[model samples]
Target: MSETPFDPTVLLSDDLLERFRERAAVHDRENTFPDDDLADLKAAGYLAILVPTELGGAGLGLAEASLLQQRLAGAAPATALAVNMHLVWAGVAKVLADRGIDSLRFVQEGAVTGEVFAFGISEAGNDLVLFGSDTDAAPRPDGTYAFTGTKIFTSLAPVWTQLGLHGLDTTSDDAPQMVYAFVPRSDAVVTRDDWDTLGMRGTQSRTTELHGATAPADRVVRRLAPGPNPDPIVFGIFSVFELLLASVYTGIARRALDLAVATAQRRTSKRTGTSYSQDPDIRWRIADMALAYDALPPQIASLCRAVDEVVPPDGRWFSYMSGVKHRAVTMAKAVVDDAVLVAGGSSYFASAELGRLYRDVLAGLFHPSDPESAHSTVATAWLGPLDT
Candidate 1:
């Protein structure tokens, strides 16, 4: 776990990746969840990858998990994206445990038992993200909280056993506290089958409505004040979420670049009497894709290792992680665009993998720490907050 690299082949073998790749297209076409892919990943102990060895898990650090995600994404972007939610909670548990806090250890333990945890923090239009919540977390006399609100983009909606979420509690001793808690799938939790989208169809990321969904007191994790805070829970979730997101997009970039190279080499031009690989324009485009994609993995890895070692981020964690994510997503989109050009008209077809990547990469722009937010975060870091 101390070392930053893990052998992905042992877990995500070539055969496994191919299976995922094959199923990816079917799932995308049908707009269905990759149920078989999930079964395979669970059978391979991938669900427990971030959990500690003592807990019967992989015991790997964030850096290794990031690499594994990249490998998984290269073959099945939707599956990797769905699984990232599970890893986020597990990563947060490890972060807390390493810091001498054991409240979230149950999440690690649950992963070993094949339980799936989905992130449920996103709302329809709550731009505050982790800093605030619009969902109501009303406390009951029995010490349980009834969370009533809608959470959009709930990945793993069909399979998640537990939903980790946050909501604002207005009646607590500290009014307006953001309560971080988890609720098991129950009658109170309603998931609408409305996940159809332009890309990442295999994810089945539907909308979830919590109709007074109850989280027992023991399930409640953190109760921090609303707004940005340097608490471990906030920092841990932010670090893991941003790093893993970057890894997935970097993997997409890797795939696009690889496909572009293969297409250029195989495509021959009668006008030039040589493969497109010999064309200067195609070569420059491929190189441009590589030049943009190469720096991402290293950047994500270094930040992940820093997160693993618990380095003092000096209040710069937001800017650091968000900047990496924003850049990776934008660069991946550009790479996929170039890849389509290299592949010729064939790539424009809906069945083409490059076309799928082009669509999947667009989802990156909608993820947390978007372009505007990322730029604002960095600007505030370097130049301080705006004037009142």
Candidate 2:
């Protein structure tokens, strides 16, 4: 498949998707990253999808990126999930550049040049989300900052060259300011091989130990007050992360629905001497799955367009973005559950695609802006903040 022309569906051709699908189970069973899939995606210029055309990239917007993610996820959820980390950084750069902030131009340029950026902001027990950091950012005399902390679930851990992370600079005159920067992989950083998980195992989202890994002064992108601030970096990360995450699960739902439909058409009922597709109960379940699955893509597209068009960021964007992610995961799980039922006893096996999807969909609950966080965001948006 040619890299140019940039059709989301065409970019993921049948042969390529088949290769990813064929290797997914092995990667999951071995608890390893999909190295071949990443190479294929890189060859297709998938990493630079969000970078600008002037910067030697496809120059697509969030809507296009999200749709492509959904398509990729349908074939290999782990590959899509792992690649999401890189796309998150590139998407953030795109979002920032759209808002006239060129601080992340290096990110865009790096991606076009085959640089891999991993998200390293997630710290254990730090529920402040993007508002706070448990990692320490000690400033150096040379104006660089030495980041010292353990980041959990650092996707693309084994291969990422630069890590985008945040740390609390407590020693600064403006103490408690969150210092966001990109740390290059070197002797200062350590990646632990402890990514064994229930599903999405191909992600290899291992633990990262940063013992004074330094980002140069030029790479320190932001120093902002923590806690619900309206910084453009914060908005960019939130918008792109939530939308791409939602797109992955939405694609999973589409795959599950398609599988359910295929099973219904192929499996014959011993009782009626006809296919399950003719059965009223089976048809109703398929329709129910389709109904839930159909509402998500348009929602993702609309929100992505809002971001692309720079539709004045507000509190409602948070509610809508988070809500869509929450709904996509919930609906995907529902669709997969129904698919397993439709596929009958065969789907109960560990080797079944629906079985694998069932496990993969559960990881969504643990991602940022999760159900509890999303609910609170929506609640606060409509009901106003609880008495401080």
Candidate 3:
């Protein structure tokens, strides 16, 4: 109901965002998680924003959550990226519950009580992503499943209480069903302190190794045929993950645009003896940045609204979702590139905010629905699958 509609500004204040901005560089320089930012957001009831009011959350929908993420990302990309994992599970739970699959009600309840849920789907070189898993999901007589494998790029690794992941159950009657489950942090779950990266370091997206980590029967959320099915779980995860990711990158574009404008206004051209804002070349660069950025928010909002309205989930939705994510990332990258040039060498300094943004925006290239995959999805939709 948040897109019915809610004000993200009211939910996230300027003062709060400024605080995050102030701390972002420090955390980035130190390659550390933004612990203070998380505490502030948790205290502000952000982690539960997508859960229904009946579940004691803000009752917001994907559209509203997208807006909130943009605002959050503008201040601290790493913080926003890390927070996205928690919000994603909440959004997925909302998506499933609205579709009459209320299996993730516990996730909703947990968020209300301040339990952090992290995504643990990614595995090294396992590019099949949601449709497949390298992890083993061994079923027990009690109906629980023990997952044994390593999950890479697990955000919020240090603090997540529940990890939502998928594994392949090759021994089940189905003989290869993909299993989705949530497991609490335990002795079996080990997080490697190996999260040093070029950008978004505050996420601490470390390697997570599940050494026969067990999920109780009730927490085993789904069992579906692997390889791109239209199960509600798959659709839900795709819809929320793509849109939220698009929102984050779009927000980075906006921040870069703003910083460029500010720099242009303050900088002076030696030959013209006036602000760079007056220089045709400088103005053109910023304008180009704006032009590229202008198309993203509306697109993200429209798609998010479509998701909120429960648009038909099929092959077409994946193309649409992936397309938006790909565009957002590409556009953000282009805008940041122009931003660095427009702002001059001063922005090249490691301490510069724009410099952090430049590095952080690059991480977008690696997220799902990557450039190649997004293009392939679009091509298949328009021209049908390549000659078999």
Candidate 4:
């Protein structure tokens, strides 16, 4: 048999790069949703990358999507975040196509109209505080589920027309079940609460409360056990999300590198006659920065391949998926930490680009499935013999 050509679609192209750079600063300073950036993505057909080709989407694999995310994040992390939620929601809609095509239409139309989307999983006091009692949904007798909870650090909520969320349904008798629901932002009230974070400021991640808001049963894609028994593909998808999120942080690091190098090249140190770029210490820092930045892409790519090969129907894929997410998030934390060090004093000042990258990269550490728990789970897997 003849070998198939290696013709995977390239998710990001040179043209997209041009547009991203052009609008990157405006969105960052304005703290507004990058509608122009999203319109560019939709116009280029990148917004629907996860919707499967059969459903009027590009059907790109997770690796390809991750690559695209890194490319976009290199220009703007906030814009990349908005795009990530769109693809994640589109993935959910794709998996639930049997219920209705409306979700797909919602994503598609949102893309066409330059309307952005965001995910709401963390709650106010529990905001990125380990996914505890932040939010929950209750089933009504009418088959509609009522969600009464506040989601904190919800990015793009102020500008999003649609939102994808995960919440617990305490009404269930068995262990708390995880429910994935999609709702229109227009129907829900967002509390314009402050997200005055140190980095990714443009994200405008705010608090939102859903008061007796009901979502149709068809929109609830998966209701799984609270523990470790999630669908493999879903778990793998989240791993991919972490990996790409790491990539975005890496891209931010790369941008910090560029900014540092540019500044160092132009300015000479006051104490030393030599330029900052020529200083041996600065050179070493730059090298370390480059090394850390270089290390993440291949690691992320390897995990993306492993995740892409996952078959959810097969039971064995669960641990592998969890392991991948664990490793990816760990790497992301370390790589972004290196980014902060590489930028040095400038990394702490709000006026410097490095400062922003440092702040945003730190936020990546708080993501679910980050180093602490990921390492714990991986350790548990390794110590399975002792538990027995």
**TM-score (all chains, Cα) for each model:** 0.98, 0.97, 0.98, 0.78
lDDT of 1 by residue, 1-388 (tens): 5844368899999999999999999999999999999999999999999999988999999999999999999999999999999999999999999899999999999999999999999998899999898899999998899999999999999999999999999997779899999999999999999988999999889999999999989999999988989999999998899999999999999999999999999989999899999999999999999999999998999999998898888867799999999999999999999999899899888899998998988999999988999999999999999999
The Cα error of candidate 4 at residue 299, in Å, is 1.2
lDDT of 3 by residue, 89-179 (tens): 9999999998888999999999999999999999999979999999999999999999999999999988999999999999987779999
In candidate 2, stretches whose alpha carbon ends up further than 4 angstroms from where it belongs are: 1-6
Misplaced by over 4 Å in model 3 are: 1-5
Q: Which candidate, 1 or 2, would have the higher lDDT against the true structure?
A: 1
By lDDT, the better pick of 2 and 3 is: 3
lDDT of 1 at 252: 91
- The C-alpha stretches of model 4 lying farther than 4 A from their native spots are 1-19, 92-116, 124-134, 172-176, 186-188, 232-237, 260-279, 311-349, 385-388
- Lowest-sum lDDT 10-residue window in model 1: 1-10
Clashing residue pairs, backbone N/CA/C < 3 A, model 1: none
lDDT of 2 at 271: 100
Rank the candidate models, highest TM-score first.
1, 3, 2, 4
- Candidate 3 structure lDDT: 0.93
TM-score of 2: 0.97
Ranking by lDDT: 1, 3, 2, 4
